[model samples]
Target: MKKIKNVRTVALDGLNAIENNQAYSNLLLNSLIEKNKLPQKDIPLLTEIIYGTLQRKLTLDYYLSFFLKGKKKIDDWVQNLLRLSLYQMVYLDRIPDRAVLFEAVEIAKARGHRGIASMVNGTLRNIQRNGLPEIEEIKDPIERISVKTSTPKWLVKRLSNQYGIEVAEQIFLEQLKPAKQTARVNVNKATVENVLELLQKDGLEVTKGEIVPESIQVIKGNIAHSHVFKQGLYTIQDESSMLVAKALDINEGEMVLDSCAAPGGKSTHIAEMLSNTGKVISLDLHEHKVKLIEGQASRLGLTNVETKVMDARKVGEHFQAETFDKILVDAPCTGFGVIRRKPEIKYSKTDKDVHSLATIQKEILQAVAPLLKRGGLLVYSTCTVDQEENSNVIYDFLQQTCDFIKDDTLASRMPEKVAAHVDNGELQILPQYFQSDGFYISALRKKV
Candidate 1:
């Protein structure tokens, strides 16, 4: 029989894979857990160590630097062992510091040479005894928030420039935390009360979402694993994301287009809103993603959605001009807003990436603009906090397209709690304020 690997050892392997870009944290860890048949109880700690280590990487490295004092260059594995252990030391109050240090030394010895083991022991011990350096020593304001919040320096500066120092810091801090699990009820299959009763019957702690009536916030348990989930009673979607399709406000028998639709969250939601009546065209760039949309529609028993593997930038080439009653350009983005769920984004994305994604977002928006009929609603949305990809893209689009104007009707369609966040026909939901993923949504109408 194959022995189950130690949780720390498995976590270290997961961290190494993430460092080498072999896989993302979530996928790698889940793969490791399943492949090794890891114990159910140990899963949480393993998850905490890996995510906590990556989530607090920059901050941990900054603290480790004070101890090393630029004295030695250790092997990457040794450095990572110390990183994971120190993550527990600094962030996890439940794990004793001495236990963390001992685990690091042991893991180091098991994974590396004796010398490396000694180095890990010495460095972590020094930190436990002496504590981290004062963050105030970082002179630059942007650098200060970057290190303190463990976000990239470029993002800190950009957010500061866009929202000013105070709000930028808030955004940075919010990215370091984990996002809650929220799901949208498929009203076609089950009402909110019906789904809530079913979820509660399964012993899952859930509450109705404050902004969107169709959404529910799951406080505990793996909600997607519930029997009700398999019944197509609901879908796992962020509450903020559930608002995008609502902003479109499609009517029965009116055709709708979802440019850049993938995984079919919004497309299926739109189909649900239509009560499976009118047609909904879900377009994705890749064939595999198109299948995802198809699968979602099939599972929801929605016959109105038609999946197509086509680039959103060339959407006008396939359909006639002004052919659809509503258009949703949920453009690809830098995804700075979703760092809470994917902490690696804090390091993976750069300013150049943000600028590049903004261009693509603009191209997709301009390409799909002609497809909307006169007076048809066009809602542009992104799961990002970057201004270049959000408000700036919309501003630039408005400059180029005189036939389109901002539609403030987005507020009237949403609950009052959600409507309060709308401004000038655009809603930018910051993660900190909403306790959900950061997102931006803007509604526009084609001039008759």
Candidate 2:
């Protein structure tokens, strides 16, 4: 108990990074783990507590606000300590409330004075006695969805307006916490069956991904830092994201382009699918990001990938029309679909931001359209659910562009589990619906 508390205190350093250093949760958390050299067994608990509190910040505050009595005041460290404690109390049944409260008091005492410790003790005891406050009482629909799902009100309003109230509420609710560690098995190194064997050998309960045939969801494993990941036996990717490579349908020796590829999860997947025989030109907006694709390619032992820095929105002037066998416009967007994986996104984004990103989506799609060969395939995708960034742009592009047609077999690569969403020349995946990030993809073919 004492050791775990010490580790929790260490994690607070990353929380400080999140607040003052402008660090991402994943990057910050990983850095803290490396620097502190925390034991592997504690990673699950530390990660759960950190991500859970961040994911449900608004909901936690809403419940805790009731415990604030007599013009109550609390310092930042006390608030953060209470947030972590309350998250454990409400979400983790294994940890007793007494233990949680004890840890909270200890953390409060270390970072603050006796006055703050007493308040922390009183507030946690009140929650233990009264239970979680009723979030159902929030009258405003936007605020209700926001608090219930722990998303920001602005995001709630935008999603409600975009995808009717019912679906929007469902999406937000699903985004609160979800299965985000889906990965694709590297068949070149080991078959899915063999990979499952290896994971099971390590006492990890793994399952085949529901949507993509080659994708696997590690239900009970932390092989990310283990030899499996380091040796490049598997790549972490959502099952829905794995669908993009299949949708592209690139054959070996074909020339392909991933115009907005950076982190190269999709680019390397394409190389693997083509049996490492095709040319995958990976272009991103920044030179520094090319190393990510290069690293992944090297780890996966994929030599087919070529990384460059070029904005897809301006690539028309550089690449000739119909020059490549396939082109991917993984356009940047509002990223609404990935909120479950990146809960902070809901708070960081605004309503106006969606439309601004939509303009970029349209521009990138339009510019990349001319670079596709007359008979080539173009697969447009985003980690967002907004229609303005999904169906709308493709609708407008087909009307204005020449020699493009919706390819019917594009959805055929998706497993039957996601067949229902396969519609109208495009298929969309919801976060919880597929137990993956919310992603949308539309496939188009340049006519001969």
Q: Provide the clashing-pair count of each candidate structure.
A: 0, 2
Question: CA RMSD for every model?
Answer: 1.4, 2.5
Candidate 1 has a TM-score of 0.97
Tens digit of per-residue lDDT, candidate 2, span 268-344: 99999888897999999987899999999999999999988888887877887767899998888878888776667
Name the candidate that leads on TM-score: 1
lDDT (0 to 1) per candidate: 0.87, 0.82
Query: Clash pairs of candidate 1?
Result: none
What are the runs in model 2 whose C-alpha is more than 4 Å off?
1-5, 69-74
TM-score of 2: 0.93
Q: All candidates' TM-scores?
A: 0.97, 0.93
lDDT of 2 at 276: 87
